[model samples]
Target: MTEQPSAAAHAKTQADFAANLASVRERIARAELEAGRTPGSVRLLPVTKTVPSDRLRLAIAAGVEWLGENKVQEALQKSEELADLPHLKYSVIGHLQTNKAKYVARFAHEFQALDNLRQAQALQRRLEAEERTLDVFVQVNTSGEESKFGLDPDDTVAFVKQLPAFDRLQVKGLMTLAIFSTDQIAVRRCFQKLSALRDSVREINPDIKELSMGMSGDFELAIAEGATVVRVGQGIFGARALPDSHYWPGFAH
Candidate 1:
C-alpha cells in the first residue's frame, strides 16, 4: 500500500491552499479596480477539472464559493461527495454535449458555454422534462478562431432571436474564449469583440447581463474588457494531472 500523508502534512497542504486563495483574490480585486469595476462585481469560478474532490473542499473551506467543472460525470461525483457544502455553487463551463444536458440540468446553477441553438433546445427539453428552469449564456467566438466552439459574431444576433422558443431556459449573457497569443493587444481585441457582441445583444434584449471571459492566463485583459465572470484554474490550483489518453476534459493546461 502507498504511504498516507500525516496530519501535519494535511495541515500544511490546507495552509498553502488558503494562502494561494488569498493571493488570487487580491489579483482579482486589483484587476477589477483597474477595469473601473468593483471587486464584488466579478464572480470567480475556480475550475477544478482534474483535481481531487478533497482539495476542492479545501478550496471551499478557504472561501471559494464558485466551482466549475467540465464533465458532467465528474461534476456529478463531486457534488455527491461535497453535498453538505451549501455555500458553494457549481457551474458547467465547457462544451456541453446535447446528450449530457440532463446531467448538467440536474446539478449546475449556470451553464456558461451554450454554443448552438440545438444545445439550447436539448437543455430546454431536459429542463422541461424535469420541470426546471436553467440559466444559460451564449458562447461567442470572440477570437474568430475556427478551432473554438462558439457561434460566429455575425450569427449571434440571429441565434439570440430564436432563443425565446426555449421556455425552460433563460439567456443570461455571453461567454467567449480568447486566442492564445503573446500579444496583449490581440488578447484585448478578442475581449473587445465579446464586449461589443454583448452591447448589441443587450440593446435588443436588456436581460442579457453578463460577460464570462478570461481564464488564468488572459483574465486581467478580460476583466479590463468587462468580464463579470472569470474562470481561473491552474493559477489557483497548481498544475493538474493529465487524464488518460481516451479523454481530455475542457481545461487550460
Candidate 2:
C-alpha cells in the first residue's frame, strides 16, 4: 500500500485540493455565463483516475460528490479504500472491456464509454445480476483519430438505437475526445460534432441529451459547444506523475 502522507502534508493537501476544487467550479460557472447558459447548468465531474485516495478524502470533505476515473480497476481500488465516505459516487469514464463489465456493474454510478454492442450486452447481464442500473454515455470519435475509441460518426445513430434493449443501461447521451491541439477551431468542431449528433440521437431516444466532452485543457471551449458534463482531472486535483495524454488511454481528452 502507498504510505499515507504526514500530518502536515495531509493538511496541506486538503487545503490545496479544496482551493483547486473551488477554482475549477468557478471556471465552469464563468464558462456557463459566457456561453449564455444558466449557471450550474453544466456538471463538473472531477476526474480522479490517478489521484491518490488520501487526497480524495479531502475532495469529499470539500463537498465533491462525484469522482470520475478512467480505469475500472483504479476506481475499484479507490472505492474500496474510501468505502467509508458516504454519498461518494464513481463514474467509469474509460474504455471498458467486456470481461471487466462485472466490476463496473458492481459499483460504478456511471459508465461514459459505451461504444459497442458486446460491451453493452456484457454490462447489462452483469448489472442485472447485481440488481443495479448505470448511467452511460456513448463515445463518438469526433476528432476522427484512429487511436480514439468511440463509435464512428456515421454509425453512432444506429448504435444508439440498439441501447434501449439493455434495460440496465440508461443511455445518458454522447461523449467525445476532441483532438488535443492548440487550434481552437479544431477543438470546437469536435465538440460541435458530438453536440450535433446528440440532436439526432435524442430523436430516437429523448433521454440522450447530455454531452460529456472536454478535459482540463479545453473545457471552456467544450462548454460553449454544449457539453453538459466535463471531465476535468488535473484542473481540480492538480498534476499527476505522467503526461495528461498518458492518463487518457488513447482518447487524450
Candidate 3:
C-alpha cells in the first residue's frame, strides 16, 4: 500500500505546483520571444497523467483550466472526481484504441493523438451517440520511430482529407512527439519535420492550424518550430517516477 502525504507535505506540494506553473509560463514566454512569436502564441497544456486526483484538484486551483491525460480511464476518474470544476476540460494526448473511443467521447473536449481511420470512425460513432463534437489532432510520427503511435508523415495529408466525412469530429490540427534525445539537433529535427508537414497540410486544409508538439525538456525548440500547443507535465508537476522509455518506446536513456 502507498502512504499518504502528510498535511505539511501536501501543502508544500501545492506551493511547488504554483511555483512551477509560474516558471513554465515564464519559460514559454521567453521561448516564444526567442522564436519571434507573440508572447501567448503557444499555449501550455499541463499533462496530469499518473497524478493523484487530490493533487490534480490543487492544479485546477492553480488556474489550470485544460488538463491533458495519457490514459483514458485515469482521465475519466479524474473528471468524475473534479466534476464540480466546470471550467476544466480534459484532452486525451495518448494513443487510444478504437474500443476506448466511447470513454473519450463521453467527456474529453479534445483528442490529440488521432492517427488511424478505425479510431476516427469509432470516435465519430460515439460522439454522434453522445450528441457532441470533439476537436482532434492527427498525430504524426515525425521522428520516424517505429515504436511511436502516429501516422506516417507522408500519409498525413491524405489521411486528414478523409476526416471531414466524420462530421462529429473536427480536425483541429496536427500533433507529434519529437525524438527523445540529449542531442538538441536530433530533437529539433523532429519538431521541424512536424512543422513542415503541418505547413503542407495547411495549404490543403486551411482550418487545420494547431500544432501540438513539445514537452518539458524540448518545448523551446518546438516553439521555435511553431508549436501551438506544448504538453508540459514535469515542468509543472515535478518529475514522474516512470522513465521516458516507458511512455515512448526506444526513448534514449
Worst 10 residues of 2 by lDDT: 1-10
What is the Cα-based TM-score of model 1? 0.89
**Local distance difference test values of all predictions, in order:** 0.80, 0.83, 0.83
Per-residue lDDT of 1-253 in model 2, one digit per residue for the tens? 1111111112236677787777778778888988999988899898876666776788788778998988887788778888998688899988999999999999899999999999999999999999999999999999999998999999999998888799999998899999978788899999999999999989999988899998888888899999899987777766554534323354333
Q: Which pairs of residues collide in model 3?
A: none
Name model 3 segments beyond 4 Å from true: 1-12, 242-253
Q: lDDT at 221 for candidate 3?
A: 82
Candidate 2: clashing pairs of residues: none
Candidate 1 lDDT tens digits, 117-226: 87988898889888889888999898888888899999998888888898888899999989988787898998999899899988778999899998877787888899
TM-score of each: 0.89, 0.90, 0.90
C-alpha RMSD values across all candidates = 6.6, 6.6, 6.7
| Model 2 collision count | 0
